[model samples]
Target: MKTKKLLTLFLLISGLSFYFSQEVVIKDDKVLLDGKQILKAEKINVLQYSFYSMKDDEEILMFRQMDNETPKYMDDDYYVLNFLTEKTKVESTDFTKILNFMNSRKAMEKLIKWLLKERVINNDGELNPERVQTFKEKYDENITDRTFR
Candidate 1:
């Protein structure tokens, strides 16, 4: 009976540790998973739009439409947009507030500029290639372009 109780306790503790350790965090101009940096900024073009990516084993695209001239679905004035590869699966979150925050021009531009200066995004408004490659190797998949539907 004592052995059974101790075994159960050990299994419970190990499961809890594994579950809590795999959290994803978006903060400080960076996205972290398991306490490691996975994404570091946004790419913005006021005349067009802006985009960013979270570097997981699979890359996830986060974007915002900046102009009315673009298609209606892409013109989400209230929220930032997210796209995932066909092979990726994510537990969804209610992104309503996050979208509202991204809708602010000043906040968006500031983030874009900071990311650019830090070279988290390049001059051509693209994610750092080395990071993309790293994700590719880890996931054994190519990053897909799903920006336009």
Candidate 2:
């Protein structure tokens, strides 16, 4: 009975994943959803495959052991983003509140990256030979593929 129940649960989760992923296509600077151009990207950036936090005003390239940040006195109008795997296209809106987040699979990919990095790189800010291998395994360009529909 235990094995049967586990199989049922695993199958259910697998089916759900397939159902949720729809096709998103890129055309020019815009992303098409359900064959509709719903979002467009102005800029795209990919760094040395480091985990990112929109909360962190600075982009932390952990492998490089450095941070990429705008000049301290720059205006707040600028925005940055990380994307779902294999895409760099994100969307922004000019609304009443802050517009500082991306609209792609930003949450999923970022979390996965952080978790993978954490595994090889132990706590206390240590980077072992294994950690360097992991970082290279997940490297992406400063502006690879952007525009997730």
Candidate 3:
């Protein structure tokens, strides 16, 4: 029984180490991946929004930034436009349908998984752009553009 417990503990530690291996650091006007510089800081932009605090029911302001060139940040739409543009042309009206699909729980979970694995968002859920380019390159090809109509 002791041996089994030790084995289980070892497995858990190993799994956790592998899961947390990806890291992002922003410093000196650059973004870094695993301590290596990856991209210029200018590529990123921060955005602000207002939300109500669940605990106090008070309105609060928050900031979230994305890569300035990202589709979600461009043109004031919520759809994944960058992924769409790479595959096919999209019209303005398509944003609504795309937003609905992407907002589903399943879709949100998958995207969040990718984001976490790629270190696009840090543990605090703030923007971490060190791995943004890598995330884009790896996932962009997997996206499929569809028309709601």
Separate clash counts for every candidate: 1, 5, 0
Model 2 per-residue lDDT tens digits across residues 1-149: 99999999999999998786444444454334446543342223432234322233233222111122434643322222333332332222221222215433343233333433445323322234454444435543232234232
What are the per-residue Cα lDDT tens digits for candidate 3 across 1-149?
A: 99999999999999999888755544454345566543333212232222222334333222232333456555533324232112321123223222324233323333334455667545444434445555555444322343222
Score candidate 3 by TM-score against the native: 0.31
Task: Quote the positional error of residue 45 for candidate 3 in Å.
Answer: 26
Q: What lDDT score goes with residue 64 in model 3?
A: 30
lDDT scores of the candidates, listed in order = 0.44, 0.36, 0.40
Q: Give candidates' CA RMSD values in order.
A: 11.8, 16.7, 13.6
Q: Compute the lDDT for candidate 1.
A: 0.44
Question: Over all chains combined, what TM-score does candidate 2 have?
Answer: 0.28
Tens digits of lDDT, candidate 1, 49-100: 3234453433444544333234555533233333344222211122332333
Candidate 2 Cα misplacement greater than 4 A, ranges: 21-27, 44-149
- By TM-score, the candidates rank as 3, 1, 2
Clashing pairs in 3: none
